[model samples]
Every structure is written in C-alpha cells, then in structure tokens.
Target chain A: MRDSRGAEFDDFVRTRSAVLLRVAFLLTGDRHAAEDLLQEVLEQLYVRWRRVQSSPEAYARRALVNRSINRWRWRARRPEQSLGDHDGVARDHADTVAVRELVVGALRALPARQRAAVVLRYLEDLPVVDVAAAMGCSEGAVKSHASRGLARLRGALAESSLVMPITGTGSSR
Target chain B: MTMNDSDVRGILHRATDDLVSPPGLLAEVRRGGRRRVVRRRAVLAAVCAAVVAVPVAGVLDLPGNAGDAPIASPLLDEPTRGDLATDDGYLRQVRAVWQRQIAQSDDPPRGEPNIVWAGDTPAGPAAYVAHATVHGMTVGFVKPTVDGPRVSTLTQVTDTETDGLEQAALLGPQRDVLLVLDFGQPVEFSPQLRYAPGGKVERTFEPVVFRDGAAVLSVPPQRTKLTVALSRTPVERENMIHIDGTSEIYFPDHKDRPGPPLVRYTLPGAEQVWGIDPVAEDVIAPTKALAEYLDPVGAHTHNGSPLLWVYGATPDGRRLLMETVQYDDDPSHVIALLAGPQLPFEAVASTTADWSAPLPVRLRLPDDQGVVVVAEGSALSYRVGDGQWTDAGRNAALLPATATEVRVTDANGTTTTVPVGS
Candidate 1:
C-alpha cells in the first residue's frame, strides 16, 4: 500500500509549500538558497513526518529558523559562499526592486536570531508566540529582537535613498 | 514612508511573488528522504559491525552525490594541539563556560565536556571535544559572537545530542561549519592526493589540524569534488564531514591557507568572471589529472589560463559558473566551478570526469539544489529546440531547462554542437 505518511507529507507540501517557500526566501533573501532551505526542511519533515505531522508547519518553521541561523554561522566561517544578487529581480516588480533590496539588505544584516524573529513576526505575519516558538526563545525575547530588527531596518531605510517607511519601534500589532 | 507589518509583508511578497516554489520539490524531498533512510541503515550497520582498528565512520561515497553533513566530531584520544592548548587561563575560561552550561542545563550532561582541542582563531579562542559518553556525544561549538560565548549544540549521533556538527566550524548561534570527524578513533593529518586522471582515484584533502580527539581542517573555499574513501588510514583523506548551502559574505581570513593552491589561473580580463569576488583557486589543483583528461578531448585554453563562465541563472537569481583550469603541463579544458558568487570551487562535477567525451555533472550544491549541465570550454552558448542562441557565457553555464543543444565555440572560432538537456 502507498505509505499514508508519504501521502500526508505530500499533501502538506503541495498545499503549504508556496508560503513556506516565501518564508524561506524572505529569511535568506536568495531565491536559490530559499528553495534549497525549503527542500532540506521538507526532507527532514518527511523523515519525521509521523512525529511532526500534527504540526508540520510549526516543525518546518522551526527548522527553517535553525537553518537560517546556521547559515549565519556558515557565513562567519565559510565566507566563500554567500547570497549573490546577480538576478534576484522580480520582473513584475521592477519599480519596487530598489525598495526590496534595501529591505532585504537591512534584514540580512541583523543578528541571525533577530532576523529570524523579525521575519517570522513581520513577513510571515506570525504572532509573537509563534515567532518565539520558531526561534526557540521567549515571546518577550521575540518582541525585543523584532523591535531591534524593525528599528535597524528603519534606520537603514532612513539612511538610504529608498527610504521605505518600514518604521516601528516593534511589531506591536 | 513609515513601514508597518503589512508594508513589510507586501514588499517581501512583491519581491518574491515570482518565485513559485520550483517544481518537483516533493520529488526531490522524497529522493533525499530515501537517501537519508539508506544512510541511516548504513551507519547502523557500520556501528554494529565488529569494532576494528578504528571506528569505520567513512561517509558512504554514493556515486554522483555529496557526502553527508557531519554534526558530532569523533571523540579524540590523540594529543591536543592549539596554541591555546597549553593556555591554562583560556582553557580555564572555556572550561568554565562548559561548566556553566552543565550547571544551568535542565537535562545535565553525563560528564564534563572534554576540551579536546582549543585554538586561537580569527574570531577568538574556541575549543573542540564537547560533552560526550561512550555510545554518543553532543558537539558543542563555542564561538565569540557579538553577544557572548555561546555553546550551540550541533547534533547527536547515536544517543547524545547534535544540532549539526560544524566540526571544521565551531557552530553556535553564530557559525555554521563543515567537517570530517572520527568517533573513538584517531586519524593523523596527512593528505596524499592519489591524483591520477587515468582510472586512478583523484583525492585532495584539505590541511587538517589534529588535537587530542578532535581535528580542525582547512576546507577549500572553491567548489570541491566530494572525496569518499574507505581507507582506515588518514592517507585516504578519510572521514571528511561536509555541509551544504554556503553563500556570499566577506572576511577572507576564514580558513588558514593550506599552503598554495594546486594552480592559480588569474587571467587579467575585463570580463568579470565572478564580478569582483575573490579569484577562484584550484585548491585541489588538477595539473596531472587535468592534463590527462583534457589532452584526450583536444580541448583546452592554454597557459594555465583561467576563464570564468556562467551557466544560465534562474530568473530568481540562482546560477552556476565554472572556471577552466589550464595550468602547468599543457593543461587543456580542465574543469572546475566557482559555484555561485562566493561558494567554494570543487575541482569537478564528479569523480568520473572525462574531458575527451564531456559528461554532464550532477551537482548537489550545499543549498540542496541540484542542476546538471555540461559546463566546459572557453566560450559557450545554448539554444532550445529550434530557438535563437543565447550567450552561455564564459567557461560554462547551467543548461537552461528547455535547452536542446549547447554550441561550444573556442577562441579559435571552431564550433562544436552538443545536444544538452537537464
């Protein structure tokens, strides 16, 4: 018989991969790297599908955070590999590409944990509790990180010509 | 413009609305899941096998696949080496940190973490040989982050814990590293590349520093060929732990120079091979192997000249580029890739590289992304079925998914068309 777990995992990926993929892309700010990250996470989820099937999205989200944080580690030591901006342009959004670059750069520059927290809080639009869960930290800590990240991104935007109104002390909403 | 949460989401959405999650991800995940299962079985067999001279922790060298990522380092019984090895003060500090972790943990460690090796890195003083027991152990990589000394648990092998051992790397909240480890065995650091092109195994090992039980290797920054050896001795460059998905950042002094690369083809060209990134080096220079392979093809760019070429990039920006290594000893179209913008350059696509009859390489970049293309020659271009030819550019390019043929033209204007598909 076809494996029930495989079917379930397949269904989850088929249905949720779009947003998960977007989460990864926003977190890494590189298209290929995002796909790579999502694939790896999904692969792990498939292996542990039985255990995490109940909350596969939560499990996958946490794994994404850990891996992105690890990517930060990778960058520190294995600096030869990095996010290349050669062709990350969205043809339909050419007008806002410059704005997106500023946002991505500001986001990418934050501390790995802070970046994870902020991306989860803002881009994924997860609650502070969910961000904290994904990041393996306290909700209070998530708020602090997101606040710092939002402020920094705002500061970066303010300094740049693309001054995106990404201003907030933190994601109070 | 005051950015709110909606603004951020809307912007990020617009930026990536085009990335519709590349097709066949489920299939890719399944294939990788199967591999992981098989790898687990293999590890189980290896562990359950009769204990020999050393633990047979050799990563299974599946043809055309990258090695498994190592998270826990093998327990070291050998003597330690690190300038900080003798530093009682720093050692005490590192130990105190470990102790602090042990004292604070809800689920405490079985025993004190044995500081296997300690070294003064460009980052700061770091230690190896983390919390362990007889059967399994947790790899704790301590690094000086902007915050403080954080002990990020990488992974656990059998029963212990491991987040993902970045052995050559000291993983924490701050760093991700790839490494080779030997559990409960000692393999000295002596790299001997049996680099022969004619049916002989070509292996190039990065320079490794061994401490008591832990060893720190200087991994090549360039795209490297995976070396899967079954030798129990260190001569085979055994127990290489690799991780995937490395990308662009600076801080060139990440790894200690493992002497000089095999060959350096720094061609002065206006064409930005990698666009102001560091020149790609043949860390495992292909001189002899390269000559043998290329001489047969009768295809080469001369004078140790290196030409950087782009395979095609995805509209969302993922691309592959290779540099032709034509070094000493009449090097011809010898191949290597500059991976992405700042990824390591592995010497080749696979072990069975034959330039005479060019073969497509099945690449498993660290990002877990795979792309296949016959990335070769000085200048290349491709075309789909009955379509216009687009500049493949440089030494090689990722074959477009719909590409039916690749037209390879040398500087001499001799053109050869090879049917290509991914």
Candidate 2:
C-alpha cells in the first residue's frame, strides 16, 4: 500500500511539476531560485501526501507562493546581493525579448508582498480570497497589495513609454 | 498608448510563457523527501522512549526506596557573576546550559546541536540553539542571568517555516538585546524587546514606487523620523530631505556614482538610533579596476554644454577631461579628449552610432593607455591615445586611467568643451 501511494505521488509530481515551475518562476524572478522553491514545496507535499492528495495542486501552489514570499522577506532583512545585468531573456525575437525583460524587471521591482500578490492575482489568476489564503493575509490586505502593485507596475512601465492603466476592483474574475 | 487590464495580464502571461521544469527535478525531490521522513521517524522514536522512561524513572524513585540519588538541580545553585564580557565567553555559558538540559532529558538531543550567541542582553546574554527532533528542528533561546543561563520555551522550526531569528543590538550603555523571530510568512511583525519601553515599532516596506530614477518609500502611521544618508560620505550628513511619512532614496546603478543611501531611525522613547541599508539590490563598483585606477587621480567633471562632458581619475595620479559637441542626426559621436597634467585636450576616439544621454566612459592608463567609451544605446568602443578604435561589444569597459573631461561633436559640426576635475 505504501509503495502504491509512493507511485501515485510520483505520478502527481511528474504531471504537475511543469505547471508549478511556471508559477514558482513568476514568484521568484530567477529560474534557479524558482526550482529550489518548487523542490521544497514538493518535499513537504510528499510528507503530507495523505491529507494533501485530495487537492494536491492547490496545496502545492499555496506552499510555493508562501515559501517564495518568505524567502524574499528573509533576503530583504539580510544584506543585499549584487544585482546581475542579465534579465533571462533568451528569446529569438528582439521585440518579444524586450517586452519580456521590461515586464519581468518591473515585476521584480515591486516590494516582496506586492509582487506575490500581483503574481498570484494576475499570473496565476487566483481569486483575492485564495491569494490572501496563500499569502497568510486577509482578503482585504491581498486586494490592497494587488492594487498598489498594479499601480507601481503601471508607473514603471510608463517611464519606459509602455503605459498601462490599473482598473477594476481587484475582485475574483 | 494606454494598456488596459487585459494588456497587463497578457504581459505577465507572456513573461513566464517559456518557463518549464528541468529534468531530474522529481527524482531529486523524492530523495530529499525520503531523508526528511527518516529524520521525522527518528525524532518520534526518541520522544516515545523519553515518554516511557519518564514514568518508569518516577516510579523507581518512589519516596524512601532510593535506587538513584536525587538529581542535583542546577537552578537551585547560587548565581555566579561569571566572566560574560567577551562574546565567546557568553556563547560558552549558553552552550553549557544546553548541555545540562540535554543531560537531564531522558533522550539526548538528536542531530548536530548548534548554538549562536547574539550578544549581551539586559537579561545578561542571549543565544539561539537548535537540535534535531522527531517532528523537525527544535529551536530554543538561552536567556542568561547573573546566576547562570536558563533555556526559554523551545519552538519547533519545521522545514516549511524556516525563517529564523535575528539578533538586533539596541542602543544604550547596557546594549540590550532585541531578538526578532521572522516566520517567513506575510504577517506583520511587531517584535517588542523586554528592555524597550516604547510600544512595539512595526517595520514594513510600503510598496516601492520609482520617481525621477529614485525609489520612494512610504511608511504609514509614522512612528519614527527617518534620515537617508549617502554611504560614501556618511559623516557629511547631507540627508535626502523628505516629508514626515514619505522619503525618496536613490540606489545608483553604478557603484562609483554617489547616493546609495542608508536609512537611520530611532524608535519613540528609545535613546539609541539604528541604521539599515534600504536598497534591495547590491551596489558594487561597476568596474573594480577602473575605480582603482581613478582613486589616485581624484578627477571630476561637468559639461559646459548640455551635449557632453567627462572627468575622472587614473590609477596613477593623473587627472583627465573630455568634451563633445551635440550632433542632431548622430547622437552617438563621442569626442574623447585627453587633457591632464601632461596630455593636451586631443580627440582620442568617436562613435558613429547614435548614443543616449549619460555617456559611460572609462580610461585605461600607464600600460596600453586608452579610453573605453560606451555611448548609451551604442556598442562599446576602445581607442588608445589616438590609435585605431576597436569595437569591444556593448558591455561597460574597464579602462586603465580615469578621464577628467569628455567632449562631443554636435550635428551642426560645432564642438562643445566641458570642464572635468577631481
């Protein structure tokens, strides 16, 4: 029975790791950091597979977001590391690459909490309540983070001549 | 021109469109999971053994039937003013307390026990020690007194919630210790030190907004007055003046460039002040070699015309200056001139491509002396004292010496001169 459960967990990991990686990458701006975050969440999920198996995807997503945000906070309190010039733009097309760099740079510039809110709300398309749950904050707090984050991103993009307007009440889509 | 909600959403989706998990990720995760499971089981077994032994030992020591002598209580002993002056001494005292606790326990501390002494607290000395347990990592704080060290309540720090403790030294002669427990979650942290009288000071970074190439931080319900001082000339106290709740701090892209500020504040009713580096990104000198080269020269520069100007130092004690004329069609033409103690203002190199404002340039001196200039938006070019110009790609170049002034040629074929000095 334990071997069968392990096989089942392996199957879940093989299928969901790719989707989770994208979420982790967006949460953390670096690919290597993203993988580390995903691996950590997966390890925890494996330990509590019996309880989390009912909705493993949601559990994994929550753990990923929470851990990534926590890591960001830890880093902020500590001494800052050198900022590299590379923006991980490895696309063949120049225009697409420029836009990607701009978006990623702007996203990274947001404060840790705000960035997490923005990624969960827009990128992952999670509702405000879900985002709040994932971030360990109230729904109202999540809305505030997403609103402020969107405003900052719009302002940053405007500086680069890529103007974006923040609209909507930041509710569930 | 205006991007709507969908546009912003689309941009985010496109940014992460290409990201995919790498191979062998699952296998690695499985191995780590197995290790964690094994550690958990070991800790559980130890706990169960301790539970059974505690009752058995109690029964064995029933009133008069003394098979075992009464365990000497370390706490009952008179407190000694041990030498807790140095940090190492304080750490030793903390470790001794942990060893005593483990010896008394039915099951010894599993895994490698590690202890870190933060510093001397008002209570005496404080340290954070951790040992492995069946559940996870068991973390405990050692609060020392004149008598000896006492272990505070132990908290389990699991792999998931691994945000640890921070030892912040408060201002005063006593140098009271402030232990900050950061649980890597998004909850607000209002850590209060026993020695501090003021209501807890909550530190939070208001959302970051960039204005005029500077990051503006806003903290609401203003608690303490903040002063942003440049790290290079901290004594100058040329603070970035701001309103009560909002302050604008600049993080310069180039390390040599002035104004990566540090924020200092004192909590209300607290006599001592604390300082922290506010910028999230590290500020390193753009080029170590170029910065070293410029150190001796002490060069400085300002543009006479709005078009172009350059001034900086060389590795040796020589100053440099360069000026350029503004060209309408070809903004990239940077007229590099060598003007110092020995060299005249001779045009050394120029770029044919269009360049942007704030033209970056580095001077190579003593050896293959030349100026490596990066016209913004153009390729980096290197030229040795009026020699053949070589394309050195688009990255910033390190030159042997610093330039005192940089000159540029304008579209009207008019040359503008600028003064650069150190």
Candidate 3:
C-alpha cells in the first residue's frame, strides 16, 4: 500500500519537476540555488505526502516561494557573491547578456518580499489572490508589493538602458 | 523601449530556459524525506513521553532523588561516560535522552528541541532542552552521571497566554536556567530554575522581569553575583506605548564593565513594541510606591541614587514591578519587586497624562561601541563626535562607531554633551 503511494508521488514529481524547476529558477535567479530550493520543497512535501499529494502543485509552489524568500532573507545578512560567477549559461550575444544581467540584478535588488511578489505575479502568472495566499499575506499587500516591485524594476531597467520606458498598469497575472 | 508585463514574463522565461534539476534529484529528495520522517517519529515519541511523564512523575516522584540513586542502567543508548567529557559529546547524550524519552511514550505530535544550554550543572554535566507541543513548550534537563543519563521534565514553561518559546538562558553558579515563554507582548516574564545537584528541580515563584522588550540574565563565576538589565527606546503610537530596546547582562563587580555583555537582544529597526502601562500612578509616585513596597521586605536603595523602576504586565495580564539598586561599593541588584492581579488599563490611562511618552532622560547611549541613544523630548536633536548636531526626531539613532562625543538638545533649548569613554 505504501509502495503504491510512493509510486504516485514519484509520478507526480516526474510530471511536475520541470515546471517547478522553472518557477524555482525564476524565484532564486540562479540555477544552482533553484535546484536546491526545489529539492528542499520536494523533500518537505514527501515527508507529508499523504496530505500534500491531494494538491501537490499548489503545495509545492507555495513551499518554493516560502523557502525562496527565507533563503533571500538569510543571504541578506551575509556578503553576497557576484552574479556573473554563478551564471551557468554559455555566453551568447554581448548585448543580450548585458540585458539579462541588468534584469536579474534589478530583480535581486528588490527586497525579499517584493522580489517574491514580482516572481509570483509575472513569472508564475499567479493571480493576485493566489500570490497573496502563497506569500501568506492579504490581497492588498500583494498588490502593493507587486506595484512597488514593478516600479523599482522599471526604474532600474531604465537606468541600465536594458529596456525602454515602462508605462501603463498591468494586471497581476 | 519600455517593457510591459508580458515582456517581463518573456525575459523571465528566457532567463530560466537552460536550467535543469539534477538527474538524481528525486532519489535525493526521497532519501531526505525518509530521514526527516524518522526524525519526526523520534521527536513525536519524545513529546509523548514528556506529556505522560508530567503526571506520573508528579504523582509517583519516580527515580527517587538524583543524589541517592546509584547510576541506573543507560536510559538512552548513547555512551554516557565518554561522551560527557566534551560539549559535543554531552549534547549528543542530551539528544539521546530526549530520543529515549520519546521512544518510551505513545505516538504524539512532533516538534523541534531547542537546546538552551550545555554545561556543567550541580548535578554533574547537563544540558537544558525544550520541545514544543500542542499545549506549550516543555523544558527538560538531561544529566549524564556516572550511573547513566538522567532526563527529567522541568516544567511546562508557558500557558495559553503565550504560545511559544522566545529566549532561554542558564544563569548562576547553580546553573539555574531561565526561559522566556512569550514574545508577543512588549513586557515578558521568564521562569527561573534552582537545580539541586541530585536532579531535584525547584522553580522559584519569583519571575524574572523583562522591561520593555528586553530579556537578559547574567551569572558570574561567583555564586552570589547576578545582574539583569532591561532597557529600550519608548515609542508612542495609536494611544498605546511601545517599549522596544536592547538587554544587557553585567556583573556587579566589573568596574570598567570590561568586554562585551554576556547577552544582548537587538530587535529589528521596524518591529514595533506594544503594551499597556500596568501601573496607574505617575512615574515618580509609582517608583516611590514600589520602593516603599519593597523596603519592608529587605529591598534597599543601592547607594543614594534614585530607585530606577519599570512597570509592565505578565503574559496572564498581571501587573509586575521590576526595580534595581545601584550600590557604590557592591554590585547592583535587580529583582521582581512586586506582582499582583490585573490592573485596568483604562483606570491607569485616566489618571496618568504622559504614561505613553518616552521616559525623561536627557540622553542615554549604550556604554559600548554603538552611539545610538533614546532621547525624551519631541524637538530633539543629536550630534555624534564633533560633527554638526543633526535632528534625531525624538527616537533612536545609529551613529558612527568612531564617534567621540554625543550631544543632545531638548525642545526647551537645553543641550547636553555626553562625554565619550576612551
């Protein structure tokens, strides 16, 4: 009986690992850290597999966001490593690389809560309510964080010349 | 080109395009999960043992007294004699006893063990550990004696008024451990312990008072020396006062106040302190009342200095008075001067006009490296070193470490320059 349940968990992981990994990558802004974040979430989910298996995707996503935010907060107390050192991807066009660098740096510069709000709102395409649920805050808080996060990112991108002027409001999704 | 939300999404997708989880990620996670489940079971068993042991030990007083019993058989599987030699070994022994306690009981909920302290106790070598349960945090003492490892539940340190463990410390020559049970309120009361060498744990009814948000305990090598100081910057908002500050522990004999404080609590810059002033009278009146209250009971003034007093509430809403005596020749003494049933906040507010305002001290900075200080007046200004005095807005300010002097000006245009120690 336990074996069958384990098999089900294995199947869930196999099916959802890629999407979860993508979300983790966007949340952490680094491939290595994303892999670590996802592994931790999966391990936690597995420990309480009976309950979490019912809503595996939702539980996994929430855990990822929470653990990512925790990691961001912990990293804030220590000296940060240079981003270029952790970029595992091969260099492509210099212009594209510079643009990617600016965008990633801007995302990292936002406070942990704001960064989480942006990742959930844009990359995961979660609704404002769902993002709030994932962040363990209210919908108004989510909207406030997202708005401030986007405004900061816009300012950063403009200063770096990575993108054109940012204007107009956007829905959370 | 201004990037819209869609463009932002597109860029995020590209950033993560090449990322892939390791091939053995699933296997690793599964293995990690199994280990976590095992630990969880062990912790649950321990909590269950504690919950059951509380009543049985209370009724039967099992294992007799610590001094009388010949070393019983190893309660836990760990090597007691060899392991008790080192701190790491002793902690492992402590963990083993905790695990054994859990293993002996029926299935219970799992929780984390906060190892408060590991050192030589009067009962030999011991470690203080606490685990949370559905009810509250249960503190335990694990002692590794020549006979075997002895584990006993100290007491349930919290009630429904508070939910979790905030801070803990083992103080005094007897290694009396103090546990702060709640942090939700500005004022916190911690239970102190008196450990008889033979495994007898007696809880002194007199609680350690933490003024503002400060909880600190200091126990020097000399058994007679102990000092507890609670200091914080007072902030008033929304008709209530917030007491948030740092706590420092000092020995009375240390004239130069050498080295760093034994313990310090630095709250975040953004965390608000909130609580009602439990005392009804004016600050001086309350101080005098408290002094008169303690005088008959052997509480004396520390020299000629005015008695410094702080009033707050326990988790259960009881009013508590904490006072300190500064002795010129001897070390300063701090105690929980008085405690009584709840006082109505409304009644207190009605009588006192400035109960929520900052305590009046011209300027009070940390005696150590930091130049931050809490001032009393509204139109307050401060200067660090010989620099121009900047407007400090009647709150705390973190100045440069190289600062040589601190100057503060009050709303009435009175300025005072504090002499910085070399």
TM-score, one value per model: 0.36, 0.35, 0.35
Predicted candidate 2 versus true structure: per-residue lDDT over B37-146, tens digit per residue? 75477567756776787776743322212313222212112122223324566667677787777555433355445653244444455555666544334456566555
What order do candidates take by TM-score, descending? Answer: 1, 3, 2
Q: Which stretches of candidate 3 lie over 4 Å from their true place?
A: A1-4, A72-100, A159-173, B55-422
Predicted model with the maximum lDDT: 1
In order, candidate lDDTs are 0.50, 0.45, 0.46
lDDT of 1 by residue, B90-206 (tens): 777777777776555433356556676777655566666566533344455555566656554443333221212333442333333333343443433323224355223344433
Candidate 2: segments with Cα more than 4 A from true spot: A72-89, A161-173, B52-422
Alpha carbon lDDT at B211, candidate 3: 36
CAPRI-style class, candidate 2: incorrect
Q: Which regions of candidate 1 fall more than 4 Å away from where they truly are?
A: A72-89, A159-173, B50-422
- Tens digit per residue, CA lDDT, model 3, B271-293: 12214332222121232232322
